[model samples]
Target chain A: MIETKNLRFSYNGMEVLKGVDFKGEKGEFIGILGPNGAGKTTFLRCLAGILDCRGVFVRGKPLNEYSPRDLARIVAYVPQRVEPSFLTVFDTVLLGRRPYMGLTPSDSDIKTVEEALKRLGIEHLSLKRTNEISGGELQKVSIARALAQEPQILLMDEPTNNLDLRSQLEVMRLARELANDGKTVVTVMHDVNLALRFAKRFLFMKDGKKMADGGLEVLNERLFEEVYGVKVEIGEIGGVLVVVPI
Target chain B: MPMDYEAYTRRKAFIGLILFLSLLVVSLFSLSSGPYHVPLREVLGILFGGGTKDDRLVVLSIRLPRIVAGILVGASMGIAGAVLQGYLRNPLATPFTMGVSNGSMFGASLAIILGAGYSLNSGQVFLNNPYAVVLFAFLGAISATLVILALARLRGLSPEAIVLAGVAMSSLYVALTTLVQYFANEVQLSAMIYWSFGNLARATWRENAIMGVSFILVFFYFILKRWDLNASTLGDDIAKSVGVNIERERLVGTLLSAFITSVTVAFVGVIGFIGLIAPHSMRLIAGGDYRSLIPLSALAGALLLVSADTMARLIVSPMNLPVGVITSFLGAPTFIYLLVKMEGRR
Candidate 1:
């Protein structure tokens, strides 16, 4: 299980994450919903140990207890977008195995990379340059890189931002598959319906604080209006709850 | 969509590069032939078997040392350029861009103005060198590196910050070098100016041996760290997530690049553009895989400088022009052409 207690972060004397508490059990898929500047990325960075925050604890250990490499081995982070000017897809995926390989990669490393690429359906693009590929393909490549690390916890920040309809569905399906495989998956998503459909649990953030954290039934029009500061219509479709702006 | 053609082309390109490097080594020996009229048989005899005293002296003492120096300097600059470019993730990034060359020039010019250049005229000075040219040059290079690195830290050491800092430091060093030139006497100024233009006529077997060993060792280190370089271009966050210690890698990489640049500039005066252009050309040909690009850049760099030095000697006959002048003359037009072509393609 991955848990954060009273995580607080500030940038240039301005608070971005204010005493946030979050938890994710094994095999749980959690979706984070937030507006612009709502501290979604910051919270994820704090969880990934990429940012030093106050009052943060993970797995009964302080954040500082684990080195960057050790944290990376436990949590695999996929950023929103990565535009590398020089690297092949295969090479980018191979970098995910760095913590495991000291000097050179072994045969098992290559097999893991191949399997990750195959799982992401980007095996054909393995030889192409990262910059030359399309945005959706790059997103898949980034996710593939994270998956290749074989971490128990996966953190993604708006991973489906630039993807098309089919690509978005593919990504969500993959996320669901990963969660089914017993990985704790935490993803930041903008689409409310997609999040409700894919994530068993959801956390809503507003003004750098957690507004609500519960199951799909806990999200209603009044709660959405209060959290987003805007009127929204909430309804059920095919047993999945969704919110739309009014 | 097809794999066959790309595989074939890649194989052919690799074979071609190997053949070209071999031919370049042969051309280095052939450079002994011009106006001096050294026979091919005598050159070969001196190279393999012991030959006449005069043949051995000419081949072993003069031509061989110069050729070896050219190869080593070329390889050093090439490898340093590749490493810097990879670290900065910018096509224009180079050791010279960080003010290493201009700083070395200023250090060398200061030594010359202080009469240190002449202090090493005893013929055995190479063995017991007390003049401060090399020491000052190394200090200048390291200080410039520190300045650029410090400025880069202001914006979190992003690639853009590093490049901008390099540009600023380069301009500052150029101004300092100009100031040194203004205070020098006529003879000292001429000597300093010539040294700044670069020459390889002072190559000794001992220096070549030192340079060769350092180049090979550092080159292997770069090869080993190629994966870290590859990951870094993806950005600091991603690189960290992939288990790379970004700060440590950058620190080690910058230090190694500065060390190689200092050693080369200490021996051969300031040779510009080789470190900038060689890596870019290698990237274009080899497709940006540092594992392949680093070694290929080294070979291409060595070949280019050796050929340029040979042409510098033959283009002006006995008056041998500065190798730096020749490289700039050749490199500038090619660089402009590449810029235009890249723009057009875009």
Candidate 2:
């Protein structure tokens, strides 16, 4: 579980998160939807403890009190884009276990990495250099790396970017399964339908403030118009609610 | 798609064995090489204390110390370069990039010009008070590294900032060294110039022992931090996400690298190219894993420098060319070849 109250962050004297408040629980799939400059990434980074902020808590403990290693044990974050390096897919995934590993990787560490790769269906490319992989495969590799952490909370920024339709569905399905298995999943997404289909809890942000929070009941054409300045028709497709922007 | 971890381990072991053997051959060749050629048989004989006095003197007193100096200095530079490149995540990072060489050169030049008047009780001023030059060199290097670190701290420890600070500090030290050179007398100027040429000929048994001990200590320290280095190469943000204390690790790693480089430079002037080329060469052979890359770079560096120093001795025979000169000639071409080969691969 994670909680934040009055969390404020600033850069160059400009406030990005203006006294924002949030609460998340285990086994919950949460999607954050926002327009440009809605402070979505900054909020996620604060929750992941990547940026220093006040009034952020994880499992009833203040985020600042946790050491980096201790925080890594409970939370994993995948950034928007990772630069390709000389590391192999296996090694990149294995780096996720760095907090738990010794000078050399233990047998269990390697096993965990292998399992993460398998879970992401990327075991076939484990030995390939990260630079030699395709964009979609690299995205999965980054996810696999975060999965190797085996954390209670997962934070992903634009996880579906560069992925094909099938891969996107597969990744969303995987996130659903992970939440069903009792892991907290927090993702910042631009695809409204994908978020609606996969995520059970929705949070809409506007101008660095939380505009709405809850289930499907919180979403409406009026809220969409206010947040995104776009008129949208909400309809059901295959018994799933879909938002169509006009 | 499972990895054959056993096979991978065996292959790395094989490569390590071959490198160790190559280093052995080069070491033996270096032992047997000099202005006065001591035969391989005599070199071996002297090792077990059964050679003639002249052969023993040549092999043990002169060539042995020089060979050890080359190995220590080369090994330190190689590992230091590897650590810097990995920690900074920059291929161009080398030991001298932190201003260690320039700082040591300034210190050595200062001692050469100023301490020429200082005498010792033994009446052998140069040998008896060698510590004056080495101490100054060590202080100079440490102070310059500290200044670079301070600037880096002020600038958020960004790679570009650290590099810029180091370059500025390096220019400052070099300018100060030139000032010393301008004010030097004839003997002091030549002595200072010879010191900067980076010859192992000045190696003494005591100095070799000191360097050997430092090399072993620093090598083990780096090996212990190999995992951190691997995580660091992924960039600082990811390194932090993976639980690495990026700032602490970067500071400590850079300081250790500068320390090793300073000690080597203090002892053996300013050897060029070994630090810059050794890690790149090893990365070409091995992958980017720091565990294998660090030790492999050490062996490769020791091999390259020993062989180059041998050529420096034999190129014009009795009049020895500075080993530094030979290294630049050999290293630059090899580096260019690697770059072209890498580009071709892409």
Candidate 3:
């Protein structure tokens, strides 16, 4: 399990994650919904052990106590943007096996990378350079690289940004399946409809603070106005709650 | 359509083998094609100890030491450039472009003006206190690394920022070298200017041994960090998530690269463009997978330098145009061709 207690992060004096508190249980799927500059990414980074902020604890220990490799074995982070380079997709995904292998990748490492590419449906692009792939394929490649790590907890920041609609649905489904398979999955998302449809729990953040946290009970007309600063109509569409801006 | 990955890796391995074989051929050709020319078969005979005394003297005493120097300097700069490009993720990043050479120039210049009492008479440069110049040049190169490392650690500068810092540092070192040259008399100034024109003949067996050791150690270190280097090319966030201590690797990588380059430059003076050209050419041919790029770039560097130094010795026949001038002359056009090819592909 991962949790943060009153986490606050300042970027050269201006606070981004101001006293944000959160926790995730095993097998929980959490969709962190927020507007721009709402500290969602910063809070996710803290959980991934990339940020050296106080109050982030994993598995009953403080974040700093674990070695980098140990933390990596437990948590994987997919950033908002994955830079394209000269590496082939297979080689890029093979980088995830780094913490476990020594000198050169072993057979198991190769198998794991192949499995990851297969799972992400990028096996066809294995030998192609990342720079040559389309944006949506690149997003899948990034997720496949993260998945190659086989982390128990996955943290994604806007993983579906460059993805098309079908790819976005596939990613959400994968996240949902990972949570169902007893891995903790947390994603910071801007699309509320997709989040509401696939993720069971939601945490709405605004101005570097958590404004709401719960299941469907947190949804209401006033909540959208408060969180996104826009009026919206909330209704049930085929048993899933839908929010339409009015 | 799916590409065959196993075949792709096999192709890269084949390319690497070809590069290694070519390096061998270049080395032998270098051994035979000097002013006191020995035939290739005779060169092989000399290698097996059956050549005439005069042939042995020319091959063993006059040519072998400088040829060995070329191999060491070229391979050193090549590996340095490859790893620096990997770490900084900047296409233009190399030990030369990162201000190490400029810093060495400043240090050599300072050593000259501050009483090394070097003299250049009728275009033949001589340094009385060569060791002092070497020491100061090494110190100057390391100082540039220290400043950049400090900024990266303290200020958390991005790769782009670090490259820009190198540019800024290079300009500063160039200006400082010019100022120091301004204070020197005719002999000292000319000595410094000639020193900056990389001469392979300056290295003897002792310098070659030192350079050989540094190159071996650094090459193994980078080989060990191949996976980390691969991770780094994807950017820092992904690298850290994949359990690489990116900052530590960056520091060690930059320091070791600078150390080897400083040793080479201090011994042989500044050999430009080998670092930039060798790695990029390999990347274009074999991709940026450090596993192959590391050793391949080193071999390519050696082959390139051996070829260039041979041409330098033979171009004017007994008047060796500085190998640095040859590298720039040849490197500029090849680099432009690569650039245009890359753009055309894009």
Candidate 4:
């Protein structure tokens, strides 16, 4: 649903994204894996249309050509860390419906927000202000907001950060379910094992470049060491692949 | 279905009602509060054209317009402060943070020293060249906004830097005002000091109409953009993700806030603390949802300022204290108590 050809971005004079190419299709759950400053977040922001960059296309249209409202209707992004403010969890989630709302929220908008919260298992916290919630709950609030957006394409940066083991799995499972339900889901992740557990495709990045792109075959000791500068033993536990650093 | 969304919304609605009713109550109380002390029944009777001519004069001609000015200036400052704080993401921000009040002060002081001074006698005050003072005060307020706008446009200041620039601008305006005061003789200096005392009594029906129009137009504009403001408090990425053009909205919101504040301050002089207290108080009582906040703050602002002005009139009887002084007296302690409560919660 979205593709980029030679996408380049820079902050000041320092180039952060160096001609990275990517194409995401419907029903594809792709995990972008890289260490610190792999241009992962930058690439996700470019796809999300938060940054002004050329050569990024959504459904064959230039990203910059779409108005913010039109683009938001089709593409929703969940950032790495969503700040906790004085907003109730329900209202914060209702913000996702903004692209489709008039001045006042409609009944459908409110219903969708409630359903989104339920999906994230945060329905009980709906009345609670975000500042009163925990880190993991806040992250789910962010994801719930994105889910409420009802976008065709979802881009998440570190969707699992600040989440506990169970919440992380639940969120990753939700992303996978979204992909399976005919939406394109792309997440930039730090935990290789968690990505392997749910994400169907993996895109490895390093030094502002795409290091490898594929499934399990793309992952090996050499690439892991070269990309993450670590020695890892990739093994199976309970028929699921897990990356353990030795 | 599992959530208590109905209860939450109902609670907010209730809060809005209380604020609205309290504002009405305080306004009526202020009407009967001045030197003549019109009774509440006579005040209502005056409204229906059944009171004494003397009572009618005291209630309608003198007090009604001042109450209207209180509502106008107070609501204007309140919403302006709320919008400013939201757009800038700075809790410390008010229209005053951008040097609006100080700039008006500087302008009025300059006018007075330059021969626009009027005599203060027999517990009455007048601006001999009122138009000149208003024009200069407005120009001064707009100048502060322009300088800050230029800083953002030309140099691309971060929101934090813009707030700092506002503080520096305020320092500059204060220094310039003091310099103006330095050159003033005794009468001119006292006039300048009195001019700094925020006076709702200065508003006749004409001034009230202008202030009312400005507040209504600006209030509607911000209310229409409340969702974007809610997204704004979360920061840029999410705000953009939600289809808000944060930059454009920020600029427009800032300009409008500065515009409304300038229009009010030019007529009423510098009313401190109403702007700061109203918005923050509403935020604490009802969370900072701009949907509720924008209106709630307006009510709270009107309620706070009119009450402060009334107390200023009633405290010494016959002689009036500066409304700004009363606002500071009410605002500082209340704000401190809120901060302590907020921090204690954590």
Candidate 5:
């Protein structure tokens, strides 16, 4: 569904993504794991085409060729944190359909937003202002908004960051279900255990390079130490893979 | 949850419709209640070319121009304020905040101190000629806008950067205006003082025509871009994520807003608080949606200014108090009430 070949990005004369190569397919939940400054977020942003970079493609078309409106229909990106706004949840989610909407939202757009809210179990919070909601509910609202875009690929930057335990699990479960429903879901995560439990594929990045890329087999003590400079033990809990630092 | 977004939209439309009707009634009332005391029947007749010569002179030749000019100025200032506030995502953002008013004030002061030949014998100074104060004020306002845009471009067009640059420019212009005030003689001083206070009495049929045309052109531009303004309130990157061409929209929106403000200020002097107060008031009455907010703010602004001008005309009978003075008195209390209401909500 998405591909990048030798993608390079720099900021202030410093190369943050040094010729990185990555690829993804439909119905895949990929977790990007690395330590601080490992270029995970930058790589995600490049894939989302927010940064001007060459060699990034979506469905075999070059990223640069797509207008912002067309590109929004193909990929939805959720930042690490969104500032609370005065708009209600429904209104904020409806903003996701901006690319498809006219001056006012069409019936289809409104229906899509409603479905997204219900999917996230946030239908009750639709009328409340976004600022009046909890951080966890806000995360769900952000996800609901992204879903409202109906994009083929979803990119999230540390969506579970600052979320409570239940909210974190719920979001991961939703991502897993989205992948099951044949959408490409890529997320940058710090919680390796959560990533291991939910994600079907993993990419470990270190110092602006991909250190490992595979299934559960790539997740080992050596890979953890190489990417994060830490030792970890891997086990199975309730038939799900779990990673814990020892 | 099958929420009724349509119902909310309908409610907003109803509120907007009511406000428009109120503005219509207020405008007719203002047209009828001048010193000449043209009756409502005669006012309607004059509008349709059926009234006596005396009633026609009062309604069509004199009162109609001022009323139309007041509406144009109010609507333009209100829309400009709403656009700037939404674009910059700051409640305090207005045309005046961009230093355009101060820049125009400085230019008017310069013309007052230097061009003394245009003063009337009745102790009132008017920028009646296009070659004198009006021309200088236009140049000053346009130049200020261009300079602010250039500085904002240098800093990645951050809202804070633009606002801070505007504040600096505003202070410098104020200091310059004060310096001009210090050097003025009695006639020039009164001219400068009255220009700063903002009077709607100087508007004639010609000026009203120009203002009306400008208001229509710019008002439609804002209406077309209202959705973009809503997207912008979500922050720069997020707005971009939603397919909004942030840089292009910001540039065009700010330039248009500044242009509207320059035209109004060039004609009517620095009418403070209308731009600052009208949009905020509209936001409170309506929701944050820009589609409804823009038109509603325009009507509410016309209503506020027309009502205030009518009151100014009534409080002292024949001698017209500057409409700016009335707006300040009315706007400050409403502004304080809004601030308190906002605090209570939070």
Candidate 6:
């Protein structure tokens, strides 16, 4: 489980996260929804221990108590855009085993990378240079790299930012599958409808504070207007919550 | 399964590196086999067992030490380049860009012009003491690193800031070196000029031994930290998430590479472009995996310099041209070719 209490962060005297409390249990698929500049990235960074914050706790332990390697073992993070200059897909995915391997990677480490590539359906691109591949392929390769780490919790920051609709749906489906396989997933999403379709819980943020944190049923038109400051049409479609802009 | 793509690639790279190293050895043997006519058997005998006194003196004292120096210096500079390029995620970054070459040249030239070695009671001038040259060179490199770091801090540690500061410091150091040369005596001026062009003729057995040991030590140090270096290329935030202590790793890597560059420059003058070009070539062939790229770059670098040095000697006969001139002559066209190829591919 990962948890944060009274988390506050400020940059250049402007607060980005203000006294936020959040938690995620094992195998939970939590989708974070926010307008632009709502501190979603900052929250994820703080959770991954990439940013210094006022209060953050992971598995009932203080964030500072865990070393970088230990945190990496527990939580794997896939950034939005991973622009590797000249690495091959195989090598980039193999980097996920860095925390486990020493100078040379072991056969088991190689196995893990192979499994990740297979899981992401990028086995054919193992030898392709990362820079030469398409953006969508790179996105999957990045996720494969995170999966190779074998972390209990995964954090993705706008994973589908540059991807087209098909790639976005593919990534979303993969995230859902990862959650179904007993890995906790916390993803930042800009598409409210997509988040409502797949995520079991929703975290809505506005002006550096949590506006609402609950199931899709709790996300009504009033909450959307309050958080996003725009009228949104909320309805049920085939037993799934559908959120659309008015 | 599927030929284990990673293993296959690594095996191919390893074999290619071995082939390159063997070629380098052949070049080293050929270096000694010019108009003087040292037989291959005799060269081999001299290398392993003790040969005739004349053969031993010629091969061991004159050629072998220089060849060893070339290999070590080449490998050091090459690996330094690979590390820098990997760290900055830019193909153009090398130790020279960090002002290491210019600063070391300035320090050595100052020592020469001021007669620091003569005042220290050394029969040979030009700061012949290895320790003194290494110390001064290290100081110069470290100062440049600090200045670059200070500039980078101003811009929140962007690669552009560090690169811009490095370029500024390199220009400043070059200007200072030229100033020192302008005021130098005839002998000091010639010495500075020759040193700037670079040579392996001063490679004594003692110097070769020191360089060999230092190169091995630093090479292994980087090999151990290869993962951190790879992570760093992904940027600081991503690196941190992947369990890397970015600042510490960067500090260690930069210091070790600076030390290697300083040592090489102190002994061999500024052998331009090997550090900058060799790693880029290796990256083109082997991709950006440091575990493979670093070792391959070292071998490729050794092969290139040894061959270039051989050409420098044989091309001009007794009037051996500077190795640096030959390297630049070869490296520039290859670099341009690569640039064109990259553009064409894009």
**Top candidate when judged by TM-score against the true structure:** 3
> Where does candidate 4 stray beyond 4 Å?
B118-125, B344-346
Which of 2 and 6 is ahead in DockQ?
Answer: 6
| Model 2 pairs in collision | none
Native contacts matched by each model: 0.61, 0.44, 0.73, 0.70, 0.37, 0.72
Question: Residue-wise lDDT of candidate 1 within B1-346, one digit each (tens)?
Answer: 2263247348637844783667465564554565675777677767786688877877788777887888888889988988887777776778888778878877877777777543233322221232477677767776788877766555467777777877788788889878987987666666666567677776688778878888888999999988888878787778878877787787678778877878877877777777866676766555567767777778777877888888887887877888999999999888777556534422
By descending DockQ, how would the candidates be arranged? 3, 4, 6, 2, 5, 1
Native contacts retained by model 1, as a fraction?
A: 0.61
TM accuracy, model 6: 0.92
Q: Give the C-alpha lDDT of model 1.
A: 0.78
- Model 3, native contacts kept: 0.73
Candidate 4 lDDT, B87-111, residue by residue in tens: 8988778888899989999999998
Residues A1-246 of candidate 6: C-alpha lDDT, one tens digit per residue? 889998999989999999899998887899999899999999998988888775888889998899888888888998877865577788888889987777788989989999999987889999887778887888888889899999989999888877888778878888898888898899999988888888899999888899989886677889989988899898889987788888
How displaced is residue A28 in candidate 2, in Å?
1.0
lDDT for predicted candidate 6 compared with the true structure: 0.80
Model 3 interface DockQ: 0.73
- Cα lDDT for residue B108, model 3? 92
Tens-digit per-residue lDDT, A144-238, candidate 1: 99998999889998888778888888888889889999999999988877897888889999878998998876788887787778799877777
Residue-level lDDT tens digits of model 2 in A1-246: 999999899987899998888998999999999998999999999998888789899999999999999999899988888766666788889989988877878889999999999988999887666767888898998899899998999999989999999999999999999999999999999999999999999989987899899998888899999989999999998899999999
Error of 5 at B107 (Å): 2.5
- The order by descending lDDT is 4, 3, 2, 5, 6, 1
The TM-score measured for candidate 2 stands at 0.93
lDDT by residue (B1-346, candidate 5, tens digit) is 4536667778879988887888788888888996779888778878987988888888887777878878888998899898888888777888788889999988878876787424689865665544588878877776676788887776566887777778888898899988988888777787777777777767797888888888889888888877678778767656777788887788778888888888888888777788878888776666677888889889878888888888888789877888998998888888888867655443
Better of 2 and 4 by lDDT: 4
- Candidate 1 local Cα displacement, residue A7, angstroms: 1.4
- TM-score, each model? 0.91, 0.93, 0.97, 0.97, 0.93, 0.92
User: A-chain TM-score in candidate 6?
Assistant: 0.96
Model 4: reference contacts kept, as a fraction: 0.70
Off-target runs (Cα >4 Å) in candidate 5 are B1-3, B113-121, B128-131, B182-184, B343-346
Report per-candidate TM-score of chain A alone. 0.96, 0.98, 0.98, 0.98, 0.97, 0.96
